[model samples]
Target: MVVPKHGVFTTRENKVYQMKKLLVSAIPALALSIAVGTAQAGETLDAVKAKGFVQCGVSTGLPGFSVADDKGNWGGLDVDVCKAVAAALFGDAGKVKFSPLTAKERFTALQSGEIDMLSRNTTWTLTRDSNLGLNFAGVNYYDGQGFMVSKKLGVKSAMELSGASVCIQAGTTTELNLADYFRANKMEYEPITYDTSDETVKGFEAGRCDVLTSDQSQLYALRIKLSDPNGAMVLPEVISKEPLGPVVRQGDDDWFNIVRWSLNAMLNAEELGVSSKNVDEMKGSSDPNIRRLLGLEGIKGEGLGLADEWAYNIVKQVGNYGEAFERNVGSGSPLKISRGLNALWNNGGIQYAPPIR
Candidate 1:
């Protein structure tokens, strides 16, 4: 037998050894990719069905978006999105649980499967959608970053905020936008970061910071939480686009479809003049679009693996998108925000959705 040099191998042996090493090295990553792929392959619906509810991640407490009442009941535009999903899945809007999370904890909760979906007024960005293994279902709220200053500060515009100390929630795109806006305008600002929206508002209220910066919608929401809601006013300048919406894990397209279409169903229902008050009567209408959306004909939720009455259930239980907005954040609510960019496309705003059929 030929003696091989120590720690060396023949060409054929070396090839086998290298292949084995490569396989060994790749096993963990390969296993992870396969596992992720398997998990993404339409398992969430079945899992949710087995559990009898969707566990939704929401903001700890952001009024008009996601906030809990004194009685521990949650309601808001974002919460309604979760309710819509539950209604679509279970024919019952109440078949969902909410986990309150801060800006930093939202994604980890979704990634780790702590929640079936995140409906926490989260803004959709390229990094979040592509890099974070998540997908934004759709834009439920079209918003922009703005500053809220105490009227006592005599600041009327964001341009007047130069050198001001800004209280901002940490782990949000607001930080980057604030930096960019200040840098581009040759302004200097001292940032006071907090872990939650409530904390940021508290910092502002405590005079720890001169200004509070967040999405304009959130500014309205946070302002209402203050001891004197009218004491602070939102600046007129809109610094950045913030299309806030629901999010889900990337691997599960079926679950994604369910969430996306659930929102779309609401938008479509609004466009077709369907509302919670009239959904039952509209179900018998001869309009193809209305019929299709209400599951009277057309696809009838077959493609989404949901009941034919999924859209109807969503509208009846959760209301249409416009109703949710008006009820939670618009004229009817404390915020009383106007339907500016959030109006339907036909109504001159950009809130459009694909047809149900």
Candidate 2:
């Protein structure tokens, strides 16, 4: 493990006092203005390195994104991204500590520093990005809000539902979006609100609701829990743009860069044809891009406070972005989300990245 060099809190006196080291949560942050002048000292990278793990905020129980097994083994799309971050930091993907939170608690958790970063399927919006003091590092999943209705309803499209009672997760932006959509179109809806996704799915399946509304990706996961999944169909209307990305606390630039670049590195790797199974052979290849990406001859990784071969370590340990997507949600996979918007820009999608150089 690469341990960062530590620094001490500057003190002028010859002796250190520890008897009354008291901290008050209620103390006005006005006191902090006196004791501290700048944004918290070192970046989050150094702190995470010193702590030996990345505290990643994730979804509570999204199946293809962040679900644990009976033995507590975590494996999913978001989990893989966290693992990739761990690999970039410590060369070992197992060093991540996943902290799951509900939609209501997620942003608050990141703000309070309860988690180092948020790898949840959080939508990046103006309010979240600017008003809430959070930064979206990069988009990992390109998604949009959609409707899922049972085939028995015979609803071919979302526009067909004028008076349908929809089962929708209560605390998310989906609720507001649904309201606006229905109101603008002059349609009436009975919103069957639920505190959690499971409850919403249950409400839809138990004949309590004729439709369910949420992110298209989430609807795909929720569809499987139905007794007759084939009886339901997700409508083609994508109501809103949900650019899902890993978010970091606003103040730490270095930590945010590390997380952001780590995700871009994975995307770049896949675009360059670098895969986990063949990274070893490519390590000694003749391609200049490959050498630069693997940090064989470039000083790229050092900028992110990581080892020279950070990208190589991530691809070797956690696999590429496509591999992560395929393992969790793809053809022959359970969550089967299409690569429509998530595909690379070269492949007629918008998932492009800046040059590493």
TM-score of each predicted structure versus truth: 0.89, 0.88
lDDT of 1 by residue, 1-357 (tens): 867664455545656666765786776667456545545534677789988999999999899988999999999999999999999999999999999999999897787677889999899999999999899999999999999999998887888888899999999999999999999999999999999887898899999999999999999888988999889898899999999999998777898999999999999999999999999999889999999998889989899999999999999999999999999999999999999999999998999999878
Q: Which 10 successive residues of model 2 have the least lDDT summed?
A: 11-20
Please count the clashing residue pairs in each candidate, in the order shown: 1, 1
Clashes of 1: 1
Off by over 4 Å in 1: 1-42
Candidate 1 all-Cα RMSD? 5.8
Q: List ranges where model 2 is wrong by over 4 Å.
A: 1-43
